[model samples]
Target: MLLKTDLTSEQLLAVIFDYMAKISSESKLDRVLVLMANMGREMIVADRCTVWLIDEAKQELYTTVAHGVKEIRIPAGTGLVGHAIAAGEPIIIEDAYDDPRHNSDNDKKTGYVTKSIITIPFRNNDGQIIGAYQAINKMTEAGKFAPKDMELLSLAASYAGKSLESVMLHQEIVDTQREIIATMGEIGEIRSKETANHVKRVAEYSYVLALGLGLSRHDAEVLRTVSPMHDIGKVAIPDSVLNKPGKLTDEEYEIIKSHTKIGHQLLRGSRRELLSAAAIVAEQHHEKWDGGGYPNGLKGEEIHIFGRITAVADVFDALSAERVYKAAWPLEKIEKLFREERGRHFDPAVVDVFFAELPKLLQIRDELTDKE
Candidate 1:
């Protein structure tokens, strides 16, 4: 909320126009939220700010950007935010505590003291209220939010509803994609007697490692969706080879290794990036960092980065899970195995990054566990 530079009228309009221009279904909402809040602070000379969306069905206001907050949701007509929404207009409070409508509970809960405040309600084209933008504790020497602050905030809040709708559309598309990816991955694994959640855990672990290794968010999400198909080739193997309860015989092991090529062949030459990436991961996930793995035996950096990442992710999840042929390894033993396998069975850099993000990896494990 602290101003690094003075806000001129031209600069303020520039910030608003920039975000408005970028507003679309695929635009990054979190980045937009941060920018909106920061720019609001600069404009109002306030120490804190929040942008909250209304859930008309539930008659609630919720915000994800509040300070020290996981999420804050309050019923409509409950506080200053509610008052502004219910009034369908802006409210400026010079003395926050003096106003009965002000809610100090959030301030107390977050260890922040509220002194002055401004609230602006956003309205849709239909004249329905959509949300409220609230700024708290003006840092000006007067220690008060002026009418001009309310006027500027109202103008900014007007465009927020359009941005929110775009974000919702984007989220709907992503949710549909998640279901489709999970289904495709599950189809291949379920046929082989493997745990249905194996593909999911692999996908999650791959994403974590991808992000830890400095991959872009787009690349990380792509890997998460595509890594699930690493074993799609196993669908071609006979059930006798796939679901064998005991150790695989030498001939059967060879057959199992052929799944890499079989899976790759099944998905190769697809123009779609998902299928293409899946094909590459399917073929190379079994390839080792030391060139000792089956199929191609490509070594070290010769293996594709996606393959290297998926290999570590797949091996970690497989080793730690209880399969029909083996007991789950102890967490400590798994840790040691990965450490020992670094630069031998796994890419040294990928292994290092995988372990560095161990907490998130464990969380992913818990999130996509096999049903008991």
Candidate 2:
């Protein structure tokens, strides 16, 4: 059955605003397409609506959302939708078959005979065409799109462009923030004269350990970013204590141990996620599996997961680094140390994960440092 009546102007405007709000609330591209297609079907009462997205890198179009049809891929200059995109304009055909631009392969795949079609380019705020929005079989007594129908579609597309631009802008902001944090973490490593690459390896090791232990991706990312802060306390230690070529006396050792508490003081009382995780890493990165560590001597599960994961990563990197007081240990020796310390000094689960990825860890070690 075809819809013979037109919706009032006020009703149509309300529906468009509602569609915008729904699209804004979604983050995933697929979900946005689904929302858009469903809204298009209801707003215009079309027999079927399908959304196609442009793969700018590939110069091809791919299906994003579909109803009553299988998806299709068309080159940017291939058919009606493709021509619309290339021309940056909409095309309305009263008889799809009569139009030379109509591609029958899409109808063949969907098993839905195309009577009439409306194809419009979906653009972003910059006026760049991102994809095509097509409604097939407009379900009308006349079986044609009038000038008024085209006007309404143009209006909807204007809003769609702005909405898509908003999403892309938000993603860019998130990527920029992550890059800033990574750079800041490296800066913190440099404060102790440690190589930037060393901090990267520790963070990677922490992420792998968390993933191997069945932590969520979000948790793993948090640990990876926060793990580098484990040694931030070293910045406060005196140069005499930090750069000594020989063993520290009892008095100098006390000053070195104070770094853990000093780090905790520097990072506590933060509500931001990474900062809070950093505070945990600073305060407990040195804590042993048994009740023999400093500050609070928290043992077993009393330690936070971020601290536990970072402890394994920090210790591994330290043993493999060439400090003034110690030579770098061989990978074999580091393995032995982990085996010996399991559940007594290091977390048993973390140690297991470390050994599981020992080969990759060695690769990361080599890639990060080649200087003996």
Candidate 3:
């Protein structure tokens, strides 16, 4: 009941090359792992496949994002997969049930039978063992794992290790950037003595709105990372103006409005895409949809969509969260204000999308509630 392959070695190499090329374009960690698992299934002609990465901190092997069996973890040196990992080599088991190293607890738990398996080890640049790649129940006429299967699966696992390394390193850089962003945003907020977590809430809210407005995930992520700097310019404002308990006088209000330009000046001219996007958001977040707001009275579609989307997110989070000068507005009042300001203070499309996805927005707000 299996399809046999008549392809030559050259064809298999071509297939592996194509797999590498395809995965290169994927960046998300979960997507990359699932893709790797599916690729292994095809390469080894297996009925089921999975990838397990080591949790060095926990000294265990755990599933990444592979589908099928529930996410599982087993201590190092526990089973066949573990045995191959501990040995630092690929193992082709023709009869998994007879292998003393085979772990049958999973089969018993899932009510599934184990016939054959190939387990390969993944290594880092330093040749350190990092994880295991496994293919279950090879489906060819021979009905067993082959030597070539080990070589190909091992090569695929190596590619996966490199990809994982790239993604992890990129995440580290992203985390560092966020720490700096939060630090800068917090510094600005502290100057105004504004409530905590304002920047974080705005970033999350902006990301939600971006997705609702049909921005690509990459674009949404850019907004999520950059929107926190919307008020980065408050750093330069005098404490008297920034931290005023109540309403400000005319001159004070005018100075407060200048913070937008100040923020823009601080963030502009960055070669980094994140900073460049944040610069636009900082400069235009206060701009209005009806030609009445901001340092520049740009109206309608003239306002960069980034600013328009951020405007809705920034105000929604600001009003919902308790502020230094004001109590948190009830959800009823917030929804009414969004409805009332639809085309006046905010972009109509942005406001509509916000309400349409209210559940997700509220979940984000409640989950990331500000600390005391």
Candidate 4:
């Protein structure tokens, strides 16, 4: 903890400004909240800090990054932070247990005794209160939050509020785009008379495979969001070919294969990162590692990693689940096929990742199992 008296006022202001700069550049909400909490604890010289956001839709206060606690949710206006938000002011409690507004449930749950607390409501750009910053157990010799602590926390809260709002808006937009992609993927599946869960399972499996192959979380999430559209081209296929219960003749099969190019054509022109990725997945998910499989038969690493990973995920789901034309293969059969085709039908590394993440993939399958 940085002792409040150790820094001159100018030094303290410099430290706060430095932290604010970091908070402004961050795009992730959870990371922004963590920075805000760290800034509050350092400025106030407190043992811990929590940045709580108001969930207006749920009428609750939630904190995903609370110090020493798992994610928690409490009714709006239920605790000290809530009270501060409701009153639209800063609060200093020398003894938390003695205050009627303080909630001891967390203290009891964590077995950490609360001594002093200072909470300051934070506002959005419009000056409407959106959340509160709560610092606990002052580390100074006084062992209690002073008015100065409240002032320091207030400054941190003011900057954090705006940054949080911006990051949250970005998150909302990303979430909407993901939803639209997944919905479009489902529509394509439904057009071919396949279950919606097929797309969901493939997306989740692709995420597991991507992560197992050492893709960054953000990239893995991008794969998850767009993998559902691997078969989007199927929407363009004639229903007779797409939904044929019997074996497809060579001509019908060729027509069926054109969906990949169709899906790519539909999404390839988009400037959006999500759509661009979806185009790759739509176009090349069936390409073989040995230059034997599809539209262009791109060989080995020439295939986009996104397409390679989706191939394993899509094939696994397709083989393991019962389809109109075939019964679900047993686990042994699926494993045998994967082993035999490790470097032929699939990318060797991707096939390895699929087996490594098989447990998680199976869990995803069970969780999103298609309804009978």
**Per-prediction TM-score:** 0.71, 0.62, 0.84, 0.90
Candidates by TM-score, descending order: 4, 3, 1, 2
Show model 3 residue runs off by greater than 4 Å.
1-14, 182-187, 330-336, 359-372
Give each prediction's root-mean-square deviation over alpha carbons. 5.1, 7.4, 3.1, 2.6
> How well is each residue in 119-149 modelled by candidate 2, as lDDT tens digits?
8887886678887778777665666777777
Instruction: Give each model's clash number.
Output: 1, 0, 0, 0
Give the Å error, residue 242, model 2: 1.2
Ranking by lDDT: 4, 3, 1, 2
Q: On residues 71-108, what C-alpha lDDT tens digit does candidate 1 reach at each position?
A: 78999888999988888878888888899998888778
Collision count of model 4:
0
- Best of the two (1, 4) by lDDT: 4
Clashes of 3: 0
CA shift of 34, model 4, Å: 1.2
Which one is best on TM-score?
4
Off by over 4 Å in 4: 1-14, 249-251, 366-368
- Alpha carbon deviation, residue 285, candidate 2 (Å): 1.0
Kindly indicate the candidate among 1 and 2 with the higher TM-score. Answer: 1
Model 3 C-alpha lDDT per residue in residues 164-206, reported as the tens digit of each score: 7787677667777777777887778777776457777888888
